[model samples]
Target: MKDLPADARPREKLLARGAAALSDTELLALLLRTGTAGRGVLQMAHELLAAPVDGGFGGISGLLHAGAEDLKRIKGMGGSSKRAQLVAVMELARRAIGQQLKEREVFSSPGAVKQYLQLHLAAKPHEVFAVLFLDAQNRLIAMEELFRGTLTQTSVYPREVVQRALQREAASVVLAHNHPSGTVQPSRADEALTQTLKAALALVDVRVLDHVIVAQGNALSMAEKGLI
Candidate 1:
């Protein structure tokens, strides 16, 4: 890094040409600050992004999905401080996306909705059932993880979901859950559960806008699939 020209440095290049001009490696290297052992910072960033084909979370998106504990297993990330910085950045990204949904119609940016759900649920090793409560105009009111573990129609109580929707005064909702098996395909049980909840919520004047199934780097919209 020292031998590189001033403008060639990540910090200087970012300031001069803007962040968009920097490669993914350069952007990551900026956060890393320095190389480790025999690896240069740029080289390390590249390796982390590339990872390995089998069981490795390859690329930038996958790296973030790897989370803090997974990152600890990687070389050059022995320092807790470095891991903290990455986790902090990921949290900021979540909040920033959440704020956008709060301020605008959640459906206006469907991709953001998927991304928000992914950041929150995609990394989980177990099943998680969550709901996004929405106002009259479809902006986010609040999101809650209402249930966990096996998400059967019986296990995920409709009574609890209806209560929360009422508590939030939500007019509509988006249901979501993560598949830790890395398969985003909604099961027959998933379809049955969505229908069960939709009917239960309908009694209270709440609409189930969508039910999304998420896994690492994948998502499925029940609404889009005509399963809702």
Candidate 2:
């Protein structure tokens, strides 16, 4: 990487033109910093993303789930220091998103919830059912992951969901889960689960505002589709 002209380097380009001007690979190169023998930092970054760690292109979502050991398996990332840096960077992003969600009020509109949850859940390698409990005025009370299951299915218990809502004294809630297959379309089971949770929460005088299915880069709201 050092052989390149100073203006062509990832760090230099970022400083001169801004981060928006860099590609995903370039951003990754910045994080990696250097490369192993015979490989440029940019080449190493490309390989890190291209490795089939999670069956698909190990994009940002794969990186989010990667551990220090997983990173060590990458050809140029054997060093503990680099692996720690990568893990710290991913954690910082998650916490920053969490802080942002905590500061905002959740509303009937699904935009904010989708944007916030997508950062944390969309990249997950397995099924996770979660809820954002809200106050009477629709402010966030808590966000909890209630269930986790295999790659294809998660068993969501409406009773457990209701108990958590009641425990938190929540007035309303937003339901969400991710499709690791990168599809935002809700399955029949998803609709059934939503109805079950809605009825359960309603029994305690709490409302289910929406059920969102998050995919790689998109989300679907059951309420918007009139399925809620």
Q: Each model's TM-score?
A: 0.86, 0.87
Give lDDT tens digits, candidate 2, residues 106-160.
6643576787777668877788889988887787878899888742224677878
Error of 1 at 142 (Å): 1.3
Candidates' RMSD to native: 2.6, 2.7
| TM-score of candidate 2 relative to the true fold | 0.87
Candidate 2's displacement at residue 19, Å, is 0.9
- Cα lDDT of all candidates, in order? 0.89, 0.81
lDDT of 2: 0.81
**Residue pairs that clash (backbone atoms under 3 angstroms), model 1:** none
Q: Which residue pairs overlap in candidate 2's backbone? A: none
Worst 10 residues of 2 by lDDT: 50-59
Q: Work out how many backbone clashes candidate 1 has.
A: 0
